[model samples]
Target: MSEKWDKESILSLSGAFQTCRILLTAAELDLFTILSDGPKSVEDIARDKSWDERGLRIVMDALAATGFLQKSAEGSYSADETMLKLMAKNGSQSILPLVLHRNRMWESWSKLTEIVKTGSNPNPLGMASRTSEEVQDFIDAMHVVGSVMANRIVESLDLAPFKRMLDVGGASGTYIMAFLRKAPHMKATLFDFPRVVEMGRNRLTQHGFIDRVEIVAGDYTKDELPSGHDLVLLSAIIHSNSRDVNRMLYGKIFRSLDPGGTVLIRDYVLDESRTNPPDGAIFAVNMLCATSAGDSYTLKEIREDLETSGFVSVNLIRNGANMDQLISAEKPR
Candidate 1:
């Protein structure tokens, strides 16, 4: 390592959660959206948002120091242009929903110690019993993320040879839209939960893809996947499942494919060390806090499970910026 690693670095790592909490709190308070109009003094913002002036000022200054906001000589703070575009609620490229979803995960993360001790999440209803609004937020957050990443993922693959695709657990049809936009001849079946399939219907219609895509509703864990597709996409799904669950899913995908069909998985495919992609390592902890047996996996584990499911010719397609790597395997003819 060229850079010096020391105690200060460890201290900084320990304090990193403070910055995360600050950003999450700011998103929850809609601070960036509030600042979208223009600069605002502490008193003005606190009064408008009905927050304590002193505390709001402190947080605003913290955000300014973090380069998310700019502090003016007039002692007012404003969101930076990037922040306005990406973090504001109504901005064209807004990721506010994703930030808000993280805010929802705050409570689960707080129980990390307990989860580690018990080998299970204490909150049984954390994901299962989410309120409708919470579910919408979660799904919308996935849409925001998927919309941004889908194009890159599509471009990374060669879809010309494939005619039909099944996007297992496809939420809101983000990847399906990307694929259809890239390959006009390709048709997709988006399979997700019933409620999520409803959202996908609206989104696909809005994207002018309702005619090209078939929306199916089912739980991949307990349901049979729709068959006869030449291609199957397991986008962002495996990380939330246990090894056995994933093995079972791979089998379902294998059976669902046409002869010599391909199954593509987009997830955090960690390297052998399980640390090359650092975000996947940290996200494993998120899984620990949120699910009973979810964790990031190494490529070896993935290949083994897929091969055991009777798939062959497994290979990596691309590695993503945030551990969203693409791995492809084939159901032998």
Candidate 2:
């Protein structure tokens, strides 16, 4: 390697959680939203939020140090440009929900040691059980993340020949909306859990797509996907399953598609080294802490699994930042 070795980098990694917790705490407190309009003194903010003034000051200073907030000469804090754009509640490109979702992950991550030792998630809820409010938050977080990449992924595809599309485990119909917006002639189906399907209904209706899309409620792992579609999208779903589980789901996807239909997978398609994207390798650890059999997979492994499930002519359509790559395969005619 050409670069010099740095012990400081490794040292910094150990304390990274401190920064994450600080940021999560701020987001949970809706600090960015509170500061969106203008700066506020610690006294003013603490009084409004009913937080201890000393603790609020420490967090605000830490946030300012992290460049998330701007500290005025008068001892007031305001949302910085980045925070205003991505953390404020009504920001144009807000990802506040995603941040909140990370906050939820904290509980699972705290049990990493036990999870690794036992090779299972310690949470009895099994990643699916959540209160109605949490379910809504998770779906909204997915929407926030999907909105950022959906258009780009849709643009990368050639959907001119396909008439109908199915998005399995599609949260809030974000990708379906993207695909439909790109190809107005295409009718689509959004399949997900019942609560997520309900959320999708509201969102699709808000986007004026409820009439064009069929919203179905079912678990992809346990239920047969809706059939008759020429295109199927398994976006951000497979990494949460083992190889056997993925193959089973792929078989289901195969049966759901018409002859010559295509199945597109949007996920972290790792290279042979499994570290080319770097993020994929790191996310594998997240899976370990959160799911029993989930992991990042190499392209070779994915191809083998797809082929075993009756798909052919598999191809990588796009490579993306942070595990958003697209891989496509076709069912034999």
RMSD to truth, every model: 2.5, 2.3
Off by over 4 Å in 1: 1-4, 39-49, 65-67, 70-77, 124-127, 319-321
The estimated TM-scores of all candidates read: 0.89, 0.91
- 69 in model 2: Cα distance from truth in Å? 2.7
TM-score of 2: 0.91
Q: In candidate 2, what are the lDDT values of residues 1-333, reduced to their tens digit?
A: 123547997778778999999999998998989988988999998888788999999999999998888899999898877778899888988888889989988877889888878877866334377888778778889898888689988888888999999999888999999999999899999998887888899999998999999989998878999999999999998989999999999999999999999999999988897776878888888888777789999999999999999999999989875767999999999
Candidate 2, position 126, lDDT: 44
In angstroms, the error of model 2 at 323 is: 2.1
Q: Name the TM-score of candidate 1.
A: 0.89
Query: Per model, how many backbone clashes are there?
Result: 0, 0
* Candidate 1 per-residue lDDT over residues 239-287, each given as its tens digit: 8889999999999999899999999999998889877587888898888
